[model samples]
Target: MLHIGNAQIPTCGGLTRRSFLQVGAAGLAGLNLPDFLSMKAAGAVDESKAEVKNCIMLFLVGSPGHLDTWDLKPNAPADVRGPFKPIKTKAPGIDICEHLPLMAKLADKYSLIRSLFHTSSAVHGSGHQWMMTGHGFNNGDPHPHAGSVIARVFGQKSALPPSIILPGKVGAVGDNLGERAQTAAYLGSAYNPFFLGADPAKSDFKIANLSPQAGQTEFRINSRRKLLAELDAIQQQVENASTVAHDTAYQRAFSLITAPETKKAFDLSEEKDSVRDRYGRNTFGASCLLSRRLIERGVRFVTINHFDTVFSIACWDMHADGGSLNNTVQDYERHLLPQFDQAYSALLTDLDERGLLKETVVATLSEMGRTPKINGKGGRDHYPPCWTNFLAGGNIKGGQVIGASDKNGAVPHDYPIDPPRVLATIYQGMGVDLDQVMMPGPGSRPIRLIDAEPIPELF
Candidate 1:
């Protein structure tokens, strides 16, 4: 019998499956394998069937108004229609905001879902929970982020974490509860999205978590690993499953810190200045560019939070309050729309040129949409009735709008959609059979990943 930490294997021969699956301290701390890897090794998952291998989720933290952006009601009252004029695109009958000219040209590369709505509270936190996790958990049993679910199910392909979120996690957006929605709640800490704490656009951008301690060298790290191994052996016997999951999380962190390839994946300096300029060289743009690099390097899931917060910044939350959260139409016309147009269009072009777009789905999501009627303060407020989000690349069929908003853009006038259906569609596009695959729910029970079916129109 061969005992490797908590994983005990019966040794029969040198070529036995037990020996092949042996996870020693070095394997756990130095090699690239999460809990999902063990499941794959045991034939629990077949990765070969996944047609869409990767996903790049660009989460627009503050929701953009459906009327002002994708679903323009040109014939409606001026108050409901807003200021932006619609422009034609390559895809016939599809016209987006004039501010998104670059995106307009590439309309054939993406599809819009203009009638998405949720009946949850209109608060930003509730919307975040719904769109990101596919379940509204105001009752406190929060669900995991979609990327975290992917990390747990798909496993890692390289030293890079299976899921990576660039810039940082979602921060304060009206309610404090929205921030926790970005976490892996029931899926455990091991599958949490790897938050890139620093801005990649900065001149001195560095991944702090990937760097070793101030006084630590390779030899010192190795020495500590030996000591930690001795301690982990004793700790394993008494700790619960949560502790074991924490150890797996630590193993992932250790592998990332020691691996040279992982460091190179986060290095923006290697990219040409021209490419960086094409991505716009700002925080959001650079993050989008970095998402491509990470995806190119075998990251299964990459999330780029366009803005981490809505306070004291020019974000999508257009309250026009004349103070903090004072984003107006000017912000959209100047900074928000232009930057998104540049970064998003560049992402599509770069991915397609590199032949990655065919295998990687890029999803643009948000908390919720702004109010259909323009506010007295010349901005829009939070409205949970309807909004727009989109998906492109991968196996997604582009160049068409799936649903529609009413004449006033108040509610769904056509095919009404919700958050879970969107997530189910994304999962199906990733080649996951919703009927066959199930997640390990709370209390180790088998439960469906989502309760809804995929949007048939998407595929």
Candidate 2:
């Protein structure tokens, strides 16, 4: 929580999120939030024709095994099936992991894409680049994230950034080159997703970007604002894209930092204790709840990274190597599965109850799927050849499985789907005319946001 002015937004423990961000002893120009808040040139699109107005993307950082989770091959050999059992859901013929009982109950709300696969390198970074940006960056020309594309097309609807990444941005995941794909590359920093550096789950959490430096009084911050205005006057003479971008960033930052309503939007204390408990009290759960609040307050896109890295911590990367990369079925049964089941289902129910689901799309994605076969250490490894991802709400039809995996859950049995098509479906579901809308491409040329079309079956 941050104390912006005389007003204070408290946490559940009665701590305040209201405080001046001590940007740095150097100056306010070093404010990192404004840097990510920079706006790019808005894309060409007819807003009146759009179907979906908002999206909440839950990105599972460490890819979960499709066989162990959604596409269970019960008849397969003992070695292939793992420990989890599949249970029937509300959606006919759709079964999920037993650990995900809550999500199983709401199966009618989301549609699973079981045949999702990519032929790119089998690295975490490459998968992240493909799923997050809809393009592989091995060729060097990186594309903007899906949220950045939305920001470029729809722009901001309120003081909040058009696109936001909750908790924090993706950090080291082995392949730094591919992991860098989370940013808005050719689309420019203006369209970059705003990363919330602090975790909302923590009682002591405070928005670092909103607070002024330690020992700095409001008078000093205001004086710096005046100084910045003077500097802007001198810089205005240039009147180029860079100047316009910085000007817009500063304006957005000041507005977000000073607005009471914007501060309230970040306040979890405003929510009922039962509501918070329903979403779960962990990092991922709090993020999901925060996403709903953000969408309600006019954020166009909100992406929740379930975990920042696939390291020593318990995550979906169940390599079971008996080392730092180890994560076994126990982790899934005890933590990962239940956490996701609770938070995801709560998000769907909350959004639908608030009437936001009809206009907002919720997407569950991952870097890739784990190996179909169990490993020597009782876990699975990364396998980019096949996986599962799903979409719900908006105009997307539910109670249906869009594609299928083979008996062994190794590859697509029918109607294989790829990453770009998924991104296209999201954009199309949001009501963007894929054929009519074109974003500014590399070198200021007009081009479609994605090369592939939306999956017709999804609609």
Candidate 3:
């Protein structure tokens, strides 16, 4: 018998126990196998009554103003209405910002939720935690992201991870904000989303984590796999739940490193020049394109963050302070709106043309809506009292508004929606039964996936 970590391997059939143990022990310490195993678990996807097979979430890092974008107030005063005018869409009675002309043309493909409000603090992080995870971090009991919970419930669809966040992770927005909101939390590390640390728009783009280090070769990789296989064989003889879970994780890591399809999935070059051009060559555009590729390749969920930080960058957080975080209305006109309109419209049209729209739900989410009234610096401040987000494709009814803001776009007028309801709608759209499906909670006890019910009107 030979020992490797907490498991034992049998060597009597071939080499001596001492030599086998020596070789196994030599390189195992550097493998970092436990962390990989802790990141994923195997479960069957229950698609018996699912309306959609996948989802692509475009997270607008900074919140957009309802009055300026979806819920326009044309009759209001200059400061209130700002400068942008609303344009008619294909859907009658629906109008959006003139800056979003492309989106207006496709209005019938999605629905807007204008009455979304939250009671939490009006901070960027609070909204991120609420919108991303469906629940705010309570005490130290952080909830897993909606995507992570989905990954846990449905499991992986293929060699690709179940849930993936493109471009990079959100960071440096505010104090005590970025912690654990994007992580797996109590669901354990296995359900955490795989973040593409590098920007895909770069010409020399490559996933650093996926590529092998210098001097590492396929031959050496295979040899390590062989050794792990022997160790796994021994463990199976005395298999327990934990051991089985570890095996699944190790197998996922092995596949990711060696599979040609894995590399092909991340390759933007495979896309035609025309298609890439349509998506634009910028970071957000490339990310949107890559998201489609990933969904096509079997990833269950893909999230594209429009901007990772609001500091010194042109983002949706239009606080026209004329300082470091000086994003203004001009930013929306020249950069933000155009960039979003191009990339987002391209994604919707491309998905529809490929016949993916029916099986994939595209959602545009943000933390909070900007203040209804413009600030002193000619920008809108954070407003959690009211905002707007939207959904399209799958079973979501399009060309209609689900809720509304007041005359001033300050509060919900009717059909008021909250963050949890939005998340519940997404879960239902993805064919998940919130009532029947449960995930492992704080202890190993099974708990309802979400406390809220799906928005019935979406169906």
TM-score, every prediction = 0.90, 0.89, 0.88
lDDT of 1 at 160: 83
Tens-place lDDT per residue, model 1, 22-136, is: 6554376654344433343222234566667889999988888888888888999888898889999989999999999999999999999998999988888898889888998
Whole-model Cα lDDT of every candidate shown, in order: 0.83, 0.82, 0.83
* Residue-pair clash count for candidate 3: 2
Off by over 4 Å in 3: 1-40, 48-51, 227-247
Q: Tens-digit lDDT track for model 2 on 1-459?
A: 421111122334554323223334213655233232232243223456665788988999989888888888888988899878999999999999999999999999999999999998888988888889898885677889999888777777788888899988888677775656777777667667888988999987678987667887767767777898899988977655566566766766776666677778888988999999999999999999999999999889999998888888899988999988889999999999999999999999999999999899998999899888898989999898889999998989888898888888889988899999999998888877676566667875556779998989878
Whole-model lDDT for model 1 versus the true structure? 0.83
Superposition TM-score, candidate 1 onto the true structure: 0.90
lDDT of 1 at 84: 89
TM-score, candidate number 2: 0.89
Clashes of 2: 18
Best by TM-score: 1
- How do the candidates rank by TM-score, highest first? 1, 2, 3
